[model samples]
Target chain A: MSITPFNIPIVPKLKKETIYSLARKGSRIDKRKLDQFREIKITLGAAGKAHGSALVELGHTKVLAGVKIEPGRPFSDMPDQGVLNVSAEFLPIASSEFEPGPPDENAIEVARVVDRALRESQAIDLGKLAIIPGEKVWVVWVDINVLDHDGNLFDASMLAAMAALLDAKIPQHEILEDGSVRIIGPPIEPLPVKKRVVSVTIGALGNVFLVDPSLEEEAVLDTRIMFSFDEEGNLVGMQKTGAGWLDWDKVAIAFNIARNKYTVPLRALQGAFKS
Target chain B: MSGKKPPFPLLKDGKRHDGRGPMDLRPIQMKVGILHNADGSAWVKMGRTEVIAAAYGPREPPMKAMILPDRAVIRFRYHMAPFSTDERKSPAPSRREIELSKVIREALEATILTHLFPRTVIDVFAEVIQADGGTRTAAITAASLALADAGIPMKGLIAGVAVGKVEGQLVLDIDQVEDEYGEADMPVAAIVGLRKIVLLQLNGVLKPDEFLKALSMAWEGLKRIYELERSVLGSKYKGV
Candidate 1:
């Protein structure tokens, strides 16, 4: 982590007001429709040194995911399972608003959301990662580096993380006679991916629902709900961010939109691994 | 130091290990204004060393104490990602990073007309995502491009390059292998138009005459890098 300065500037009130009015008319400042997402591009194995890596672009927002697997002790509560550690860095170079420092609240929130969605949904088969049950288990560390942030980093980062996991391969190892393990060869065996999880974020401004809000729209957003769904459309994880509240009807609309929008990201993720 | 020689011969048949003449630089690719949220951003790839730099603000200083009534302050940060190296580095800014940040700030501050924006701060964030060697110079070069892209007033762009001695032969653009085993390393940053050296750091040892030789070699490398910088900036605003 780098050093961060003390003061952070805020978005202008006039801009927020303009964004609010534009949303009311079913248009966005970026000219995006109410339920439209920006263009998405995914590149697999962007970080050649990492075991698995993916670079994702949601319009102007860019996120890189790198996965590193190492042998480590399993948690006491989960001896038969491997560990999945996900961390997100809101790199200072990404945006003017982001500062250089340790993971801030927003960074922590993004990491937790991505982590919960993948872990709770059982995207990776942890049992296959277990080498010695209680003693040694493979730990997968997913490091999400935000290169550029336009808006909607949550979805972009989640998509990259999931794709990186899919692209990951477990390194070949040998169980030694003394019960210790030795990494013998290059990375082999594609990670056991059980399901694909896609996270969709919906921003609310008054009575309007905006999909994939831009930075300006996010500034004026009253509330935001992130829904994480699996391929089967199961609600694996859900989190409500911001200070505003959402009634049941608005939540229902968000859910429906998330279900419908899951395919967009799913197609993008599949296309990345296909080549 | 123990009299341990380098594992491999750094020079053979008047060519360096990578099979280049004494003054040949590695391939360089640069892109400007790549980040959407940043006011100005640039990405540079010199061989395997990849760095991205972003510039924000001639805005109010973040801290009151940092405010300068006479001129704007340049807040520069140089960071290497945890996974940037062969071994994972801790995310914390080390003493080397802090010192590099100061040196990089001084290098760019020489060219920037800070007096034009008093009581303001120009933040330059440089991150080395992949490092083979000479990351400091690479970062500074990218940062200068980012500042220019940000529309910051400057006398001219600054170009950075390093000259090193390997196997008793002067070489341009030291890579990771040469950097570790080389006899001497000299990193220099200069104002491209002014021909003034703003940053100069010498490691290992060099004779006074050899120092002059290294400086000249660095100057030539700087000229090539400056051309690339100009071309990258030109491509950004072709009509203008």
Candidate 2:
């Protein structure tokens, strides 16, 4: 869980404040191209102690994701498959309304979006994580901490997680005599990573669609569509959140815009892993 | 700060298990004006624990709670994050948190000039993102800073410090491990005014002599923190 329910800074009613003038002028307050995203900045290995970590700033929205790998007994049901556990923490420093407690619906939805994108895309080669074929495997624990909440946290978290996972490396393990795993040494080889996944969030505002809504934009958005696009521009998963419905034509338009805008950041992720 | 007796008597080596000396305080980092929307806010980092406080409204008080004719109501809510520690915490505040809230409220009420705004409610919300040790103290300190930042009138800035006994020696600012495994943990909220003591809460065992000595240690460290708070506020409100 990331944020508390009582202090959720987002006020849906605040959206009403913008209806009159913006609709009259057919423009946004920030005056950005309708399809343009907020400014983005990504940094890798920010938490030096963690196995892998990255800090992502999508405009004013900031998220830090740290990946920790630990060797432990595999789940009895699926001993062979590795595990990926995602957790989120929404800090109050980001916004005044963030109360402290278990992750609220917003945080849960963010984690679920990132988790589903990772799983459905098969971004991690789980088969290579198996040590003894069916006994031991590497479990990747990704903790995403939301340091600031200016908006578009979902996209920022996904980017941070992906960047951190790419920066992570698992050590070689040997099955012990007591059916336990013994730490041998650093992995002589790197874990196999099949594909890279990233997500882009677009919001619909009064017949106009915008990408990566800012904190102010997020308050007024009626519908938000998060598109998970791979490096090849293939859509892996698309989730429509909130109450508003999107016409089929608008959905198609948003997909194309996401695919096009995604490559710019996707290339940045590749370069981040390279360095 | 290190190089003293151990903080926990039950633990071995006269060494606090968390690797701090008896008189040592945890690493603390504080930043003011973190929240854009709040009138004033602060982020306090005590060891690995992160606590944020925001002050909102001297707005019209909630009608039901406005029975008081002279003084404004100070409403406070203290909450810990679910993933702040190893164990998962429930969403709602527990008995301990509720009690801590009362202690904190009492402490702040004494220092803040609530009578200045009779018909308003000042909201002080403290959210603990991470809980290592001495969270209540940190929250108190942060809340005072937030209130000051919000430009609310007050007698003086209040700073909270804790002094606990370990291995029969007094330690300042107990960490999570020491607080959990030590002999006694005492947390105090001190004001810069002539009345130094505003709130004090102690748990576990301690002799009267030990209690007095621990109280003195807390006051000494608290004086230093109060100066820090003043300097920070001065710099923030310079020329204004």
How far in Å is the alpha carbon of A169 misplaced in model 1? 0.3
Model 1 spans with C-alpha error above 4 angstroms: A1-8, B1-240
Tell me the TM-score that candidate 2 gets on chain A alone: 0.86
lDDT of 2 by residue, A1-275 (tens): 11111222445465545742473465567776666777668898799877788998887788999987776556665667677778777877777767688765556656766876776566887766776656667888889999998888878988998988887877666777887887687544544668888877888765667777777876676557777766766555555554333443354566667777887568778777676
* Candidate 2 lDDT over residue span B1-240, tens digit each: 111233444345655665666666666688789999999999888778789999986877656545355657777877888887778999687645765665576667767787788767888989999998888889989999999999998877888887876655678888776666555667777675553455554454444456557767887778877777787788887856
Classified by CAPRI criteria, candidate 1 counts as: incorrect
Error of 2 at A150 (Å): 0.7
Q: How displaced is residue A121 in candidate 1, in Å?
A: 0.7
Count clashing residue pairs per candidate: 2, 8
Q: TM-score for chain A of every candidate model?
A: 0.93, 0.86
Model 1 TM-score relative to the real fold: 0.53
Off by over 4 Å in 2: A1-27, A75-77, A172-174, A184-189, B1-240
Error of 1 at A191 (Å): 0.6
